[model samples]
Target: MKAALSSVPEKQQQDSEFLREVLEGLGGKRKTLPCKYLYDEVGSRLFEDICEVGDYYLTRTEASIFANNLRDIASEIGRDALLIEPGAGNCEKVEALLAVLESPRGYYPIDISPEILLDAERRIKANLPEMQVWSEVGDFTQPGVWDRLSMIPSRKRVVFFPGSTIGNFEPEKAEELLEMFAANLGTGDGLLIGTDLVKDSVRLERAYHDSEHVTEKFNKNLLSRINSELGADFDLSLFAHRAFYHQLRKRVEMHLVSLKKHSVSIADTRVDFSEGETIHTENSHKYSVSDFNQLLARGGFRPICHWKDSADSYAIHYAQAI
Candidate 1:
């Protein structure tokens, strides 16, 4: 059952917000779209496919690290702590952690995609029948999402932010985001976060632009999402997916390039494209252990300990709200 908390219907309000952001982003000097929208139902499934691609190793590497050190990690988190996962798609990563946790108090998963979040809620109910789950459907970054979390009872609150989702934000924004996470927690509350380590450009490039073309589909899916959700006529065929590592920026930049000059209509708005012009889609920042630790500190968390994969391509840190 859908219930509205305000005069505006939830779905209609969301559509309005999406259309406004789309127009503002496309109207910018550098045409762009927020990466968060990339995970609309279809994009989320494609991302799952991207993770299975051999070229994209972040997922498997993190899992291996967890498989190796889950007990130690859980020991650090200790017992009776509530696990709150933002962007908790399918909530797969937490199943193992929850299994090992010593009498975990409960789980609160916040996600923008209702389909994935609901499916995860059902899975957790069946697999961990004793564990409590309170799932929220909305953007995890929104303050209201975290605010809603305050109502769930727990002995201690720990934010489980796996998958290097932190790297999606710009450095400044990342610091602010961590601070926001900190704002939602008390001192001694925990945070288990992931970060992608800096690697050779060859490896980073391959990760985003896989040979199997799944990443290509993932990138272009943003355009497809805009076309579908906002009534935009984005010609998916006219835009080519391009991804590469920027040496100086220490990040992978993904964009959609226009094959030819064209105009597209979105709702009642018309957006024009120049030949070869591109819409910057997303950035995945790479960080060294030291750099990310500093970032964690700035975000109001004192760095505790971290675990890394065998290849050192990824690192997951355990920090505390300070």
Candidate 2:
């Protein structure tokens, strides 16, 4: 496989240090966990399995929208544009774009997973031989992560952020992220973003808490990561996976709830939790079309087009940097 530029060990060290600080601070109160820790190689594989589960309709729905609208999306963006995908996990949705977009000048997949990003780049190059493939390994939220991206030699840049990854951030943080993306582009540059729509509670809850138990494994894998990385003795079996739709918040919160009163030691650190105490793992906030438009406006973008499935359960919006 082609190797993308590796993320420096210093960056990995900084990430670990940040995790330590967040854990220490949260340990003092109710324990909390950052969602980023959920994606080690194994965790990433489990998440992909979760996406395929029957109850997990988000991925299939989004893929369907991409498949149906690929030509229109490509035509709208014009030819020979630089297709840059942020948080591009596995590049599954991107393949749809590549299949339809005519002769893209370059394909840049920006992601934190160096291994996955490299493998994805290799696959894209093999399939789309005419397209130059570049990969960036860094946290998408960092300020200067895309500075090198600006140096890529393409006149038209089209940012593709699929799979409703934006839902991972709070509204304000999402707006900030969009603004950062807008700043990365010139006036006529385009953004194609996928967003999960506000849907019924039953369907939303099932999507997170899948019947196959894959999502559960994915959620609990974070503790396993802590055990491996920080020399922690975490009884992963003692934590039950919990995911539910919060009606008021309009989001699905994933948690790892203690099955019984338990004490765990991580290196020199020890923490105790009563039965049923949970570590807040992740929140995926759903949105409406108007809500999404407001977010885009806040980020200095003007919506050019929006497409949705027949049920209107999800949307793919194309916006232009204003």
Candidate 3:
């Protein structure tokens, strides 16, 4: 079971530019790293592990929703609608959908990790041999990836974007990306989105700052990645991982805070940080029901159905393109 893997054109160049822009924007203020940089191969695997942890309720909660409500979801979309999943890491949630969905012509899994994407394709094919599987390896935020996806032979397309990945984007960018997705699918095509609902500060903090500190390692791994890929000299030990809920922003901000003043060099680029200085890494924004609905409305999506687990800690929203 072999699968072809090609480097997306100019991926390296795009990555370099992305790093430069992000680092420069931080300026002398708190240095920052983009969340996208956190998914380099190993990081993706660690994230999968994180999802399975007892403290991380987002994945399991959303999975339960799909498990319980998939029949209704499938009925709404009808049979023969194409299933497309963005950031379809490992296809665990997609497998749940496939189990309930009536016979569909094809399944499209889009992701940035070639290795994971191919593995997902192999696993899905083994389980559901009748479904034709196609894979694309590229960032979903990038243009033209959808154009290539348009080649898939299906008239009605329904996109499944689980994992609350939409929370990674700022409100504006989230809306823009949703609009892009809505435009990509034909009329009658819809989106199934998972969103983390607003919750207490303590629980939110614990979710990111786990007792075993795996999330800490996940956060600092970004520096390790920079050291390896960009030829940077980053002492991962000099920094400590910090994650907290920002009540005003309604988000969790993950940072690598310097324990003491340190200087690091990446290639010819030199950066210095003072004691207590931090590098902003990632933000997981929590949304209220009203705020989330407004976002969907702005993105031209009409909320059709929403499913919540017992605690109502998270929500799985099924929306249609308007």
TM for every model, in the order presented, reads 0.97, 0.94, 0.95
By lDDT, is 1 or 2 better? Answer: 1
| Model 2 alpha-carbon drift over 4 Å, by segment | 1-12
Give a tens-digit lDDT track for model 3, residues 1-322. 2235555766677668766864584465657777987887889888998887888888888888878888888888778878888888888788867867788867788777889987888888889888787777777777756766666677678988999999988889999999999888776678988999999998988889888888988998888887877787889989999999999989999998999997988668778889999998999999987789999999989988788998989998888898
**What tens-digit string does per-residue lDDT give for candidate 1 at 1-322?**
1212334487789889888888999999999989998998899889999999999999989999999999999999999999999998889999999989999999988888778887887888899999988877788888887776667777889999999899899999999999999999989999999899999999989999999999999999888888877778888999999999998988999999999999999998899999999999899999999999999999999999999987889999999999
* Residue 225 miss distance in model 1 (angstroms): 1.7
Q: Which ten residues in a row have the lowest lDDT in candidate 2?
A: 1-10
- lDDT by residue for model 2 (147-266), tens: 777667777899899888899888898899999999899998999998999989999999998889999999888888787777778898898988888889889999989999979887
Task: Please say which candidate is ahead in lDDT: 2 or 3.
Answer: 2
* C-alpha positional error of residue 38 in candidate 3 after TM-score superposition, expressed in Å: 0.5
lDDT of 2 at 28: 65
Q: In angstroms, how far off is 237's CA in candidate 2?
A: 1.0
TM-score of candidate 3 against the unseen true structure: 0.95
lDDT, candidates in the order shown = 0.90, 0.84, 0.83
Clashes of each: 0, 0, 0
Candidate 1 lDDT at 69 equals 96
Say which candidate scores most in TM-score.
Answer: 1
By lDDT rank, best first, the candidates go 1, 2, 3
